[model samples]
Target: MGRRILLTCGEPAGVGPELAVKALGCGVDFAWIGDPRHLPAGTPVAQITAPDAQVPPGHLPVIRHDFAADATPGQPNPVNAQGVIDVIARAVDLVGRGDFAAMTTAPINKQALKEGAGFAFPGHTEFLAHLAGNVAVAMMLASTNVSPACRVVPATIHIPLEQVPAALSDEVLEQAIRITHAALIRDFGVAAPRIAVAGLNPHAGEGGTMGRQEADRMRPLLDRLRAQGLDITGPLPADTMFHAPARAGWDAAVCAYHDQALIPIKTLDFAGGVNVTLGLPFVRTSPDHGTALDIAGQGRADPESTIAALRMARDMAALRA
Candidate 1:
């Protein structure tokens, strides 16, 4: 419990700053990595030089990394994009050095990053992988202590629907599954995780009528994993896999594509959902939603997901410890 958690204030122009301030009283002891000037004028903040620095009640502890320019909520400035990226990298370094227990990120603007810094990665998941020396990683969306509580991982993410068929292969799916399986055990404290995997096509390819990927590729791989003593069930119809009864049977669901995995969690626990990175050397989590640009300064952006991410990171770290 003494180990510090770090939260990187994401895009300054978005709701990241507002949410970070709102998360101050959530009871998770964390230090912010961003410019203090970016916080709301009346927000209470205590500057810190170390990760474990303590702060008063109603005050947010901050590890300031001053941005190049003032941030205007609802209007993104590319000038500060490099600062946003720097905060993330610095937090990664600190976490890597064991200075922090876990790190939960705010939402970052990809377009602004690309325009300002020539950022090459698709998103945070990939960038973190690169920073950690190219380790295999999978994104898991989780919601706990609720009806239909579940964890989900997408085999193929951030790609066009047309490209999903070509992008997905046995290797990628296997890694996603294996990482998810191990994470359920280590991070979530599940002794015997039951994994229910979804099929790519309608009705699980309808026995090879809608698509042959399930029968030709997915089934064989799942069987191979089952034979290896993994409790896996799948190539099941995506439509039936997320209902209350079906969800009750598994600890996690590995879906064939992005939307297949995200929709259910977002639908059930939109504001409390957490995005967890599996297979990292340290725990990392983020709000399931993105930075709300329009409501940046209006105080309308809900901090529930961010709070949930922080809590989840703390719990995962505790499990690991």
Candidate 2:
């Protein structure tokens, strides 16, 4: 049998449902995990018709989770936060049970989920980690066509910049590099992954003139990974690392924080980037962009990122299978 993918459309009021519908139209074997009512009424798509529907062409298979209220574009309700969590939880459960081969999540609104549902984690990567029994995972954003195919991970995520210096550690950096290298070989099918580690300070601390984290914290970790026979380099300057010449040598770049890594990729290919989670037992991927609440129901939601996510999820699932 072909691998099954669980398409979890996140916040009802957001563009999740629309992106789900659009991806279904592309003819992938997947099931929708969301409220069926949110779908345009009477659409001629084949859905599993229940909580675990098989993919039906010109129709969508829905795993219904009825919300207490209807969703309007550009408006979010805190009351339905649990519903969003439920969709993700169920999708994870299904995949864990071997019922689904992989999962591709639509973008969700963090503020709404927190205020309405009391979700504790800041974002999907952390929340999914909790759902999966606190598995150690890292978020990687990947784009294929952008010269050298960028894949990035931040040592410190969703935290204040001031805290980054304190958070940088040899253990954390090592784990991130190990997971990143494994992801390249497994998910991306790179035989020998060339990794570039970005420095935390300007000019790689200008040789400790700006900061010592690069020499004190990062260099040792890179050295350890190299001794283990991993093809990795860095403590390289961040500003010069992302351009064509710098990217041409590396398969993926590991950065010290979120913006350092994400800014370049988002700038290079915001519309087509795919966010992949490394170190998970099962394949999980999402669009790099978020739930466009501002354009939620304007029929203006671009499906490009979502489409890229679905494709990446499918490829990863195939590799794992």
lDDT for each residue of candidate 2 in 123-202, tens digit (9 for 90 to 100): 99998888888988999999855766777888779999988887878878888888998888998899999999999999
- Report every candidate's CA lDDT: 0.91, 0.84
Q: What lDDT does candidate 1 reach at residue 259?
A: 96
Minimum summed lDDT over a 10-residue window in model 1 is located at: 143-152
Evaluated against the true structure, the overall lDDT of model 1 is 0.91
Model 2 clashes, total count: 7
* Candidate 1: tens digits of C-alpha lDDT, residues 67-93: 999999988898999999999999999
Error of 1 at 259 (Å): 0.8
Error of 1 at 20 (Å): 1.1
Top-scoring candidate (TM-score): 1
Over 4 Å off, model 2: 49-56
